[model samples]
Target: MNRLNLFAPDVRENPYPFYATLRRESPVCQVDPNGMWVVTRYDDIVAALKNTQVFSSAGLRVASEPPHLQRHNPLSDSLILADPPRHSQLRNLIGRAFTATTVASLETRMRSTAARLADEMLQRRVVDFVPDFAHRAQANALVQLLGLDPSLQPNFQRWTTDILSVAAISPDDERRMQDVRRSIDEMEQYMNDLLASRRRQPGDDLVSGLLRSRVNDCALTDEDLMGFLFLLFVAGLETAVTLMTHMALILARLPGWMDRLRKELDLIPHFIEEVLRFEPPVHATMRLTLADTELSGVRLPAHAVVALLVGSALRDEAKFQDPDLFEPARRAQASLAFGHGAHACIGAFLARAQARVVLEELLSRCRRVELRAERLDWNVSLNTRCPLALPIEVIPA
Candidate 1:
């Protein structure tokens, strides 16, 4: 597939068909512009994700770091790019703040925020789900969880957009690159200030918990803290935001399911899980070969870029029966939405909690959701899939 470019608009619009084709024709084939290998089969992707020794997470950093934006991208230094033993140390230290009880404790407050947002949206009757509900819900949840100033909530969307843009920049987009650089500086400074403030007078927040957390009797250095906070802000907010938006889209298109969910509230969790498996927020992830490795009998040279098509893997016919159908209660297998192994999202619990709360609130407030737009406008990105805007009319309960 020499002409294939995942970032191209056509492919990004609906990649599943392409993924299905690739999985059938060539499960491991090199794609265009950059001869990065794309692995589509479920077992192969799982094996590659688990075998981190051969497939390094540093590939994420490599993929994001273009020549002009090398040291400036905060994600380059974040935990997502690190491999063990450094990855282990960071995960062990930071994982303390995300315990089940702690994440659960934040739900009441999250639901409260969601309830307010839902009421406002339902009162409006017609509104864009992305900004009106999903983004706001996720932003407030992040603020509550991290004890960030509520005033700063407005900047979360911009920061997340600019920072993640680094991963999908076009060669000639100097203007976009400049924006990303500035956003990186601003976000890094904010994180540093927050870290210092937490150190002086700790609060009942994730930042303070991290300040107090220790690994092998050593406190996290300034760089580590800042990098982690950057990662946390983007991953924590974006993943859940996308998930909520996807749920809204589903509701808009599948109105009957909304009624089902409202009646069988218990099925909400299953619905979310199915969404994770079917319409995952992230479709793929990058990994670099640390040494020469072979995947599905295809030889890969050292330092080759590999895209683990987790979205495709989730729909692999081998792993999931009738993978194309959205089955909420089919007994889900392991999902790579938050990923697998050491590099799996540490904030997965918090993301899931926020989605559940927002979804439940929306269902309670609205009897049905109908899209105002004629078609979906997907956000342009390399790996993630979500609508840029979802204008919907909510019928109040």
Candidate 2:
């Protein structure tokens, strides 16, 4: 088989068919010239996630950095890229602050926010939901959650984009590296200032709570604090944006879906579940091997790059019946979309809550969802399969 061109136009459009081919011929084979093993089978992905000892998350920082270029990435201090005791400690602390109770409490206000966002979309007549709606909703929720001013959102998102871009670009891109470093430095300073202000006058927001909370009688230091904040910017809030965009795009492209959802409002959850399985926001996530390991009898060298093809595995034939079909009514089993095991996304509850509330508001207000754009462009990020824009015209109910 020719080395899989994952970013090629055909795969970008829909990768499942290509992934099925991989599962048949090279379940654990390295399909790329880069020697990165793309794991497509459902069972193997789960096993790798659970076996954190061998498939380490720590390798992310190491993998991204050039051998000669050395610098501290605050994300290195986060649970997002750590293992065991440190990971558990960070997860518990952050998790406590983002509890179901705290998130649920935001429902009333969040619902209002979503309605206002939908209203804005309605007024536009023709709107690109990706930026006009999804982006705004994500930013609004993030600002409210962290108790920061919405005016600061542009900078927050810019920093997030710059930092995440580091992973996508070649290590030789010194200018990109410099820009990312600058963003990190500025963000650290900004967070320090924000933390100080919060300390002076505490509030009910997460930042204030994070400051006050203790895990095992130990408070999060600057490193851990910066790491968590960066994670929230880069991964947590962005996931919700991608989920909402994907859901909206699904509704737009699938003619009968909205009517079906409107008739059976209870199917909303299943609809969301199916969208996650069918068009997952995250296509692949990297895991570095801690030691020499074997996957499906294929020996992998220590520190070898293993990309868990979540999008591919979701449609793995052995796992789901009619795997290629977008069947919301299919048995809703846990998907690796948000990930699995210890490193499963901590902000998943928040993302789902946001999606449920926003989609609810959208459905209630809009009678008809029309896809104005004849063609859609997908973003180029290897990890995230987000539409670049989703222009739509909605008829008011």
Task: Judging by lDDT against the true structure, name the best candidate.
Answer: 1
Tell me the tens digit of each residue's lDDT in model 1 across 192-239: 788888889998888898888886797777778777888889988788
- How many angstroms is residue 71 displaced in model 1 relative to the true structure, after the best TM-score fit? 4.4
After superposition, the stretches of candidate 2 with alpha carbons farther than 4 Å from their true spots are 64-70
Measured against the true structure, the TM-scores of the candidates, in listed sequence, are 0.95, 0.95
* lDDT tens readout by residue for model 2, 1-397: 6789777877877777899999998888776537678888999999999998999888777644545335777777788789887788888887767787878878888898899989987898799887788877888888788887778877866787777776666767888778888888888788888888999999999899888878779887877878898888778656788899888888877868877788999988888888888887777888889899888878888878888999989988898889888888885654588889898887887888898998899888987788988777877776888878888998887
TM-score of model 1 relative to the true fold? 0.95
What is the alpha-carbon RMSD of candidate 1 to the true structure? 1.7
